[model samples]
Target: MEERKKFTFSRRGFIRTSALAGGGILLGVNFLNACKESAQPPVNIANLNFKEFNAFIKIAENGYVTIFSPNPEIGQGVKTSMPMLIAEELDVPWEHVTVEQAGLDTENFTRQVAGGSQSIRHGWEPLRQTGAIAKQMLIQAAAARWEVEPYTCTASNGVITNQAGKQLGYGDVVNDAALLPVPENAVLKDPKDFKIIGKDAINVDVHKIVTGQPLYGLDYTAPGMKYASVLRPPAFGQTLKSFDASEAKKVGGVIDVLKFGDKVAVIANNTWAAMKGKHKLTAQWNDTTLESTEDHDAKLNAILNGSKFEVRREDGNVNSAFSEADSVIERTYESPFLPHNCMEPMNFYANVTAERIHLVGPIQTPAGTAKRIAHVLERDEKEIDLEMTRMGGGFGRRLYGDFAEEAALISNGAKLPIKVVFSREDDMAAGTYRPAIKYRIKAALKDGKVTAYHLKEAAINSNMYGLIPHFFPAGAIKNYKVETGNYQSNITTGAWRAPYTNFLAFAEQSFFDEIAKELAIDPVKLRMDLLDNVNDGEDERIEYSAARMKETIKLAAEKGNWGKAAENVYQGFAAYYSHNTHVAEVVDITLQNGFPKVEKVTVAVDCGIVVNPTGAINQVEGGVIDGIGHAMYGNFAFDNGKPKATNFDAYRLIRMNETPKVETYFVENNLSPTGLGEPGLPPAGGALANAITAATGKRMLTQPFIEHFNTDTREVRG
Candidate 1:
């Protein structure tokens, strides 16, 4: 008999084996704090005679495998996709796998963020290795019972088989397997032998979504939980001066009215009561110094032409290159502040006690929010339990902790569990918006080739983050310079989807189209020509994969039937690299009446190994729709320092009838997977703009292009 090695898990609830219905093995895990560097299992799962493994996997006696996905599912499908990584290496039939959503538990999980599309990218190797370790332990247990060498046993579809034709189900040996020590290292399956990854898999929540299950933050409820609505200062720089809640107190179902600096809240038995109470309350604000939208726009424009600016990236002498070039093209682009109008408006439930606080919500960053809540409550971080619910849409808006903090404050003051909900108007009026920006690009062309490029971006709050000097065209051109200018404002700005790339791609990629036209070269050929000079090496400064970038561009062009549109249909193309992913998009658009109507979109992405092709494609399609909606009609304005677009009546989104037919393709590669969440979005706007330009022979220099066109007349209104 083989000698068994004993191992113990260090986390709070590492491995706890229990009997399931019928005869089966049930395993649960908690993450080990020490095992952050590799994919090694922290505790042995095969030691079931007396002990077991940690939080993720649970194998049943009947051969069903349950995997826990520990991340927020904000319509991007990480819940269904991450578990596939583990199921693939465990060699189990995909049909036998069931996925569960895990609550926020830091001691058992690490890096549980859902933004930047990094869930799969970060969990790829470690998650697969975990499944491999579990499979090996089960194989060893089966081998011990059969009196055979472990190396001679093979496991497939949750069962182990030996060369002599003896077979045992994983459930049959899980108890003894739980007694054996875990393998120090397990070999990951080769890509060619993969049965799950890169294949189509439906979202784990699809059934619940279709059935109208309670999975969103707005649907969350707790015992004795009261709904609360807040009346915040209307303007960015304003504060509450005075309020009269006399009439609000008479509203039916109204429980209590509380006041916090700069805001007032009405707590009631239900949502409608709270909303009515808030509407009835009379309030006045001190808006003496509030700045209007025009003020901010003028400041940004002044900074763009001003001399005070910081150079972020400079290579070779751009001045000299321009002086020596045959022609220099300069154009400016602007994008306005836009809101993240999530289908489910901002809402959070918080229960506060003297000892601890419980927070549940649809947030993008739970850990960060927990820390902020702890600070606000003056409690230790460990005392707060932050649980994330499925978000209708995050789009980088939930990253802020303001809403969660408000809920905590209300709960603490009321001494009860309270759910803070924002109506459509409130969410739009108070949310942090994407920063408006001005981009000026100058390209020096010599003999039909881009020799030098310069870019200066000016913004009201702050410049784009992660925008390095060596961004795209950095290595493609000899002389490059990137500069930034800043103007101060009271408007709160935060990340929106792809962040800077959302607007930057529209500016840079569309400018490239202009350069291509000036040089009388096909846009595709111009891009490929520029890419020819890019070095494909292990350079840290190279933000984009030259090979992969070229691949996506060629693939998108081919799949889109580039330059083959009919007389009335025009095709425009744009490619971009962000979040370690390369994406190329081609838009087929036609002028309907006076407005550009997007007919179809073709996208090619290279984000390394795609874990779930179906989910990946869904993300691409949704991102394209989001991009087009914002570019066509999404814009927020301010008058007297108050948000103008406070509801759907003023804020418009892409309807189903207007959404284009989107087709997505992926390049096959053996590299580790990256994020697809935000990459597909950055180039969509640029491609649509390019297509519009092609159709009308006019360039859209400012975003929310709907504002500049007369839809009924088919002419420019600007």
Candidate 2:
């Protein structure tokens, strides 16, 4: 009989036994076969966790596993994808594990952010090190028990087995293992042994999503919670001069109407009451000078009309290239101020007490928002706590914490727990917008082959701008002159889904379409020839691997039957590299009662070391539809310096009927991972534009391409 080694678990819930689960419902996940040493059950699950915690570890008395993750999920499938990474290296069956959110501790973790498509790639190192260290301690304990060499003993799935097959489960000998020192250099598992890491695990929260469970920020309900609304000026830079709040206060359930510098807060017993109070409050606005969304076009035009500014990248003589060309084609493209329009509106709940403040919301950056709150409240950073809820959708809208600050202020002013709820209208009107962009693209093709190209871009700056250098540097372009400028608008614009790449793709890929038509060459072959001619992403230029670009172009063409002909379907192709991955798309479009309808889209992506292929593919499919929606009808326009497209009625969003059939394929690559969230976006507009051109034989150089659109409604206010 083997001597039983007593062990204790520090985790908070009942974990499954080591035994695997049955198939079908439990296809990807199986139950853990739990083994007990000296049974002292684990800590209460509630004691082990509270809101706003991620990335902690615990030991089960009956030896199981505990892991805490700090990021929130808005359907990017990080919950299932991230945990799969930990379980792979820990060699613990997924069912045997119990996960809890880690507390806010700066000393132990970095800022827990989920945007920028950096989730899995960023988490790879720290998590693997943790698993390796634990494996070393377990081996040492087994060596001491059997009086054998530590290296000779093998540990698999929480079991320590000697060369003779005399084994001890983790729980059986953890006390001895806990006493042993942590190893500095423990070997990691080989990639071939990773059964779970690269697999396409289903979303862990799919059940909750499909069941209509209360998982979003808007679904939050707390004891004695009140609602608050704010009265903001129309335009971005406009401010409130004075307001008559007496009418607002007279309404039923309207508690108080408090004034803050340029804004007014309406606190009431319910969301409806606050909304009612907001309407009654008559505020006198001063639009001394403000830029309406309409002014975006004129303002950008003025900036581009000015002299150019240097950004980076120079290979050959660009000035001489254009001068020597026999003929040149120059066209300017425009992208409007678009909204993310995520399903969940912008909201945040705050319970601010005298000493400490509790903040809860569906935000992208919790740790960063907490710090911002500390600065605004003038309190110690540690006193401010965040409880993150799952976002219905983020699309980069949650990156800003102005809504959280609004909640904190309303809670403090009203002297009650307050949930600041932005109505769909208010969300569309007052929220940060995607900056508008305009690009002047020029190309010179001599003897049916491309010779020289020059592009000048001018758009809003003092707004949402990525590094910009990384995607367009010498590595990404050769002899390409990109001059971008920003025309400040009153509309509060920030990062939208895919950030700056959305507009860049619209302009860059659309220009590529025009260039292809000029040379009278097949667009796919032209791109391939250009790719063969230059290196967009290389070590000397930034090392953007084009193998994926080549793979995806081939895939989309083959899948969509690019060269093949069909009567109703018009085909278009475009490729781009962003978010660390290269993607190519072939779009098929047809006219539906004069409305340009995207029928189908074929996508090929190289995201490298895909952790979840299904989820990644889903992003591409969804993102392509989102891109089409923006190109066709989506707009966040303004009226008299105030945003006019305030709700779904005025501001259109993508819906089920509008979505096209999207087929996505992944390139098999062993390179380091890249972002998948925004990589598929850049090709949507160009492909659609090409399809539209093929269908109608009309060139679209402007956004919304309203000329081709059939609508009874006149032009919008902005």
Candidate 3:
């Protein structure tokens, strides 16, 4: 086991404390390592004694503790889990703690974005140290009052007791502790002594979310704020030419119509009036460069066939190994563009005045978005005040701040506070989609063992990042090569969930199964043999731990009863490592009425210590369901640059009845925690595809499995 690093204060004194006006304490700790500069004492503002701090823990006279969570809450449960970290080390009872969301504070916070599942992994040590230091200060104050050494007193569960059994509550000595010097070091609790780290905790906002409270961006409203509905180009490759809004002005409650760049914004007192007025406007568009789905397919195929490629990774003599192979197996897989389909449509509230810019709503990248708004409005970044609201869902869609920028621009142009809203059609048609991609994989088998492997990817807009080629199977194969090519298009594309690995995992895992069949070996055994070839520290670029991955694979197989299911029950298996976590899954299915009926999924994860088991389970279960739903039925396409489906009525999603029961297990360990949000998804598709092939003698090489097979008569379709 790796030795854990001890948390120590910097030589410049990283902790600052201030006395509350009415006999309490406010402790501010610099949780970031880069913040070495001395911090000024927090000043009282508007009678609120607590100022902006990296992580604030305020103790009132009544012994209630409030911890401000610095990161945005995007349904990943950080609002509940992060506060648990601080409360654990502070020795405060869970019921006495209250969690609150903190505003953007660039001076104190770092890496506040919510795109990656990195909140807990990054906040583990520093947040615990914050609570530990506060406890030490309170202990010293109690020892001073007793006229004895601090080592004689112990603090636990909001109380400090001396060796003689004299006790004092934290609230009774908070004022005295606030005036003492900050301690440079405080001992963190051992894992066995932990009271709140690995336990199940309810979501802080569950009651508000379930009771229909105003918590999401669409639910947020400001005083004197007008509603806006913008009209953009109808197609991907089109630009607005001219607009006529005279008819729109005659609508009731229509305040005004303003044009910004190529988009027209309809302003009104209510959302319904704004949407109604926007529908009445007429516009002309230039579609000379419009491209269709057929165009994209042809271009991608051409790239795949051509020799113009950027080699991402190259091992020993791939060509020579292929030439000497006994046989070669090759296949191609394809996937179409996908929308994020967030439950709440894109919306933001902005008030841009001459002196300051106030922005609020659901945004993943708050500080970065504030900077972009400053650049767009030609104001200093310091003039912007940004706050984050709970999001219905992000899934990498809120990472882009275009909606926020639109709100700021509209408010600035109309000289009024504005909240921009997107209708269902607008959200779908104007979304930044997942890039369409095609992957070709080939492997050479010689002397009953795999000898060589090659993979080539052709994508629209952008190719996979450099690190993806170095993931699993790179160090295991002696002769391996990965090449990529791309064709740039006008349509926007960016990160979606796990990004490249989401589809890449399915393609590679399926290819491995085919190789296993040709070699007449069990699918799980084939993977174990490949993993045995990889050694720790052989290559610095390999991020996965072979021992940990093997453990998860074994656990999943044992729990899933691999190769031991009853008659007519088919099983498929897949394992992958991504987002600093290792996951393995087994899919169990039974055919019903010529259609695949998923029954259950067994998953094993090695993400180190589990923080908040309830939240962790929710994330894994949600990922599995999302992966299966998209793989089985999700489909999106474009005709002449126009989206084919604009609403849920046309686009199909997996219904509640189709969702399978998920059984999850974790490989318990003492290592630091890793990400859990996306790792569970990458393996689900591959496992499901393999199970479908086991049931029916057909391999699915395309997404939306519904397209390649007939649901009515169990026959292969075009």
Give the top-scoring candidate (TM-score). Answer: 3
TM-score of each: 0.93, 0.88, 0.97
Model 2 over residues 1-718: C-alpha lDDT tens digits?
2232222322221121111121000001101111122222224333332232225344454667766556777678777777777677556666676654433443223556768887766666555545555666667887899999988888777778899889887766666665554454546665666777787776776677799987778988899999999888767667788889999999899988888668898999999999999999998887766666667778888887887544544455566767777678888888778877778899999998988888888988887888888787787877877777888888888998889988987787778899999988788777777787787877766677666666666777633463354453233334555555566655677778787777777777777777778778888887777666545434555545555567777887888899795888888888877877788888888776655778888888888778877888888787888888787776666657777777777766667897888888888866656777777877788788878788778776777765455466422212
Instruction: Sum up the clashes in candidate 3.
Output: 0
Q: After superposition, how far is residue 60 of candidate 2 from its true place, in Å?
A: 2.1
Order the candidates by lDDT, highest first.
3, 1, 2
TM-score of 1: 0.93
lDDT by residue (121-222, candidate 3, tens digit) is: 887887788888889989999999999899999999999999999999999888889889887777888777779989999999998988999899999988
In candidate 2 the C-alpha lDDT for residue 331 amounts to 86
Q: Which candidate is the best by lDDT?
A: 3
The residue-level lDDT of candidate 1 at 422 comes to 94
Candidate 1 regions exceeding 4 Å error are 1-55, 463-468
Candidate 3 colliding pairs:
none
